[model samples]
Target: MQDSSRFDNVISRPPASGDIVPISAHPAEATSAVLHRQIRHDFPTIARGEGSYLVLDDGRRILDASGGAAVACIGHGDGRVADAAMEQMRSVAYCATIFYTNTACEELCRYLVDSTGGHMARAYIVCSGSEAMEAAMKLARQYYLEKAQPEPRRTRFIARNQSYHGITLGALAVGGHKTRRQLFEPLMPQNVTRVSPCFAYRGKTAHETDAAYVARLAAELDAEFQRVGPDTVCAFVAEPVVGAALGSVPSVPGYFKAVQAVCRKYGALLILDEVMCGMGRTGTVHAWQQEGVAPDIQTIGKCLGGGYQPIAGVLASHEIIDAFSKGTGAFIHGHTYQGHPVACAAALAVQRIVAEEDLLANVRTLAPILSGLLKQRLGDHPNVGDIRGRGFFWGIEFVQDKTTAQPFPAADHVAMEIAELGVAAADYAVAVYPGSGTVDGVSGDHVIISPPYNASRAEIHTIVDRVARLVEDYFAAKNAGGPVDAKL
Candidate 1:
């Protein structure tokens, strides 16, 4: 008999029930002592890695595809590589580059420079990919300064959309990934222009010829250069193969040649970021080799040390180094860990194994087999719209329909769902690098599967089989009206 209005005024009403509450102090989401060690992962805890399998702390042996984002080129826990690392660590963990030099660092530098086909005169080592990219940007900027272009010959950077350089300001400025830059837009550098990426699946018109597509893209670059004013442009930066931003998308033939010509015409340095696709992951020692052009500056990471140590580096052409030499006798961009001894040692061991074992041959041999298997199994998959990639690295782009080529809605989380199913039901611990906005900057989904270079035939087959099953099952569940796992 009480008034209905009074009863409806309850504090825990429906609308208020789900509202967020403000608390002055609270426990952190990441708890436990191990949380301090690494706050990123929840410890799916891999107990061990043998060959290409990761034995999780839960006793599941998951096939390690994508080699931890193409970092583990060689198989995990390789004793020979381990022994090399231990040897160097015991001999000398570090040496200050400013005052003295170490054998490990000097030898590694010489090896990389020599391996660079007489192009890279010098190599500088750093801790990770982001650091390498930062160094590349600073180096490129300093090169222009050293050349005495006092009026600031370069003010704009031309990079393609759906590209990822790194996380730091200078590198991030040229990076075109929307999701990653959304939060940091305020602090990013100005005058960096985003051009169209050489992505054919979404970008290529149905009736357009490959040659026409390349021309169109080249024209777009020219237009962007004009918009920014040719002399005002500093560098043309890109990943030889689009990595996290576009899921291993390679450019069409004549694409880079055209782009390179344009960059040269504009006096902009061409920076190729091979952080995820270089160092034999793409079956070639250098991804740019297939492109028929050489970059003025190149950045490499991840597989450089094969995850043996956190190491990355930049390779500079003699021209850029010469400019610096003639002017200041230095590049004027130096990092404390610019050439860490231990990192160089670890990368040397990894590189030696790749060369001695003839692993590039392995990469070439298995690439076709993996691609064939992916096509044979999931090529016709309803949910799998496109199967595209090269070398041992591949990506399965999911879509609503293959005929229409319409992507699954982003809210469906199709890529994430497929990733989870692949992990749980397939028992394959695949590294999932997903890309959104493939259609534009916001409307597509895909997953990358880059197996280690040393992965065996059986491991490769298992990866394909498991991932195929996962993709099939994901669609089955989604159509069945069951809740799809949203963790891709």
Candidate 2:
């Protein structure tokens, strides 16, 4: 056996001046070689995870309320998924797609396609949501080319404002998150145009009905198509429930149907990027299932592998697949780790667990409780602007004036402060997903509370209690001229 005493010394050793600090402490100087997301911030080192709680090196257990960006659906450290990945690795770990296909990949793909209930005809697995989106864009373009009457002029794409697809160039080009795309604006494709997002809280007028709002949005899309020449459009992309960019903002009722109708009218394909909100995050396996419409191509990730492995996929409709099969008989795009065996195995295991345990049912059951508790606790708070989401995915938006719905300035970083405070308080150490640019991509703040699908009722209560306390305390401190930073 390995020498266990060797680790005892390291574990018992006192911290040096430059050693990494706990979640609540801030190191004066940078000590690590790795380039973290924020160079100035000191992050806690997680020792291990158990279900809804993440234990730090300092022995404090934090509640993973956001599931690390809503990715951990089955929760952390699921042994069944680990075993499945190990088995796949032992059998055949890395087989190039050009040479051979592994059973794990095939099985995962088949399972995904079947879950779609015939809406999505085929699945093309990739390593991340960005890659899947890139693939979807390429395939959408290729599908138009493979048509009986090729419309070479159909090269333009239309997406929404305050939307995030992915990080890669192609995905970024099609995305509308202004802060993310600001520096890379010159590099983004000029063919892509943007429309207003389907955010009811901000987009809808006081007197506008849902039907009228949908009609107005649809008309705007139609007008954009006309402005750019209808024959030149390739696709219209959106997310059923906006994630990160607008804080889990679900579209108004009939919005997707309206947009899909407009896309069909112009012969442009509909591509839904469900990277942050798909794969059973919002009760249904696919977010579009709740809506009355479906996209021609859809990209999903985050919860797909349940954070066990990196995996995402493009789900193509039958109509698009038929065009490809009848013409090129292949998708032209490729990725180095397409349909990786171990990733596929892990995802397959995660998905199987979701199905066998009926976690979607759990999501459906708990969604109302989460929503109700959040509203009951934080609804009357002066800064709490909105509480919106479906299933386990929810966002609490902060505003300076609730009546006016005016968002706090981006400079204040209210969402980040609340998130940091949540992580710092040992009594209520809960991690939430913070987001900015909720209003027009520069000036709003919100935080997402996306618990794991298997989180118990007691866990949900704890999450709400902690998060509500964090929000209340943060704003109260800020209003009273107190230090609101977690490090303070």
Candidate 3:
């Protein structure tokens, strides 16, 4: 029999205090051919992944607590997904979507449409979340043109501040993430407008009730629509749960309903970007379900493929599809790899596994446990200002002064430090996603903890424990006036 202990023993021990480890700028970086995200930073080379742990080439096991920005919903190294991809590749790997539709793509689209209980009439599969958002924006424009009256004037979009939709030029224009949009402002489409997000932690007043806040936000959106000439607006874009741009920020009660009403009033479609928070990342398969609002056009990714393949999709409502079916009978948009069979097959397999294993139920069951433990561990910490999220998608916002809820200066890079230390230190070899601009677009820091949907009770506890210890020790060191360096 093979020794299972061989892999387990790799991460059995932690380095002693003051031991120096090279976390960045690996020796291979000097002549590495690949252009890494950070030129100077040396990333660990992963040999393989097993369940929730990533085994490095050097034989160290690192716990993947954040699921690599909440993409790996089913964890790593599932042979079933690989087999599905292989099978699809063996049959037909590359077929231009314009020329032909494959079984895998058709099945996956059907599955997505059914998942929405037929509310979404069609699914346009793409390669990434950015492409999905781009498709959604273009489709929204086409939707207006497809109408009987041909409202060609509908060219503008209203998106929430501190919200991210995608990275492409079109998607970036609609996104309100200040930092990401700053350099690209001159090149972005000028048709998009901004409105205040429904973030209760910062946007809500101390004296205001949830209902009052919702009304205030709705009024702001309405006022913006009027200011922009509602007839020119194509849609109101927002993230069901604000992802990277604002950490895992969820809206207050009745927030979506209020916004949807405003959108309807202005004859604008509601586009909810669930790239990071949907597909069972939250308790529900679709985050908008929890909000009690179904978007006219929804973009889903990340967990859609569970990191098994590069796939994202845009779901269109029946009304939009009907308009298209009657008008041009074509979307007038195309991508070379729109519905690659291998990608669709991999995503289909992942989604089936999620449903067959009943992972959403697991997520719902563990949501409270994860939230309770996080609050119990870091709720009262001097620097922990807020802990908010639903299901496994939680975020811990760090503040310079908890009483005043003042964020640490942007120069401090608090979130990145915690994330880097979590991966660098042998004592806490766990990974969490970091966000820099949680407060506005330039200041504040928060870390997202999005465990896999199929994560066990014990795995959740382990994740929380490691994260809490990292937070506590890091702050303790800061309080002691020490360097608080992960490296020696």
Best of the candidates, TM-score: 3
Off by over 4 Å in 2: 1-30, 485-488
TM for every model, in the order presented, reads 0.90, 0.94, 0.95
lDDT per residue for candidate 3 within 1-488, as digits (tens), equals: 01111111001122234423346434335867775454443567899999999898988888999988789899999999999999999999998877789999999999999999768999999999999999999999999999888899999999988877877889888887777678789998899989999888899999999999999999999999999899999999998788787788999999999999999998999999999999988888899998888999999999999888999999999999999999989999999999989999999999999999999999999999999999999999999999999988999999999999999987666777687678878888998888877888778888899988889999999999999999998888877878676742
Each model's lDDT comes to 0.76, 0.86, 0.86
Could you give candidate 1's per-residue lDDT for residues 1-488 as a string of tens digits?
01111111000111122211111012233543543222322335579888787787777777778676678889788888788878888998877777888888788889878877888888888887888888888888788888855437676788989788887877777888776677789999887888899989888999999899999999999999998789887788998888766778888888999999999988889999999899888888889888888899999998899888889999999988888888897765667876777778778898998999899999899899999999999888877877888897788888888888898775555554455455554333454455565655556777788888877888788788877766776688788987544232
1 or 3, which is superior by lDDT? 3
**Candidate 2 lDDT by residue in tens digits, 32-70:** 565545444455688999999999898888899999878
Off by over 4 Å in 1: 1-30, 33-41, 148-151, 426-431, 484-488
lDDT of model 1 at residue 251? 87
Residue pairs in clash, model 3: 25-42
Q: How many backbone clashes does candidate 2 have?
A: 0
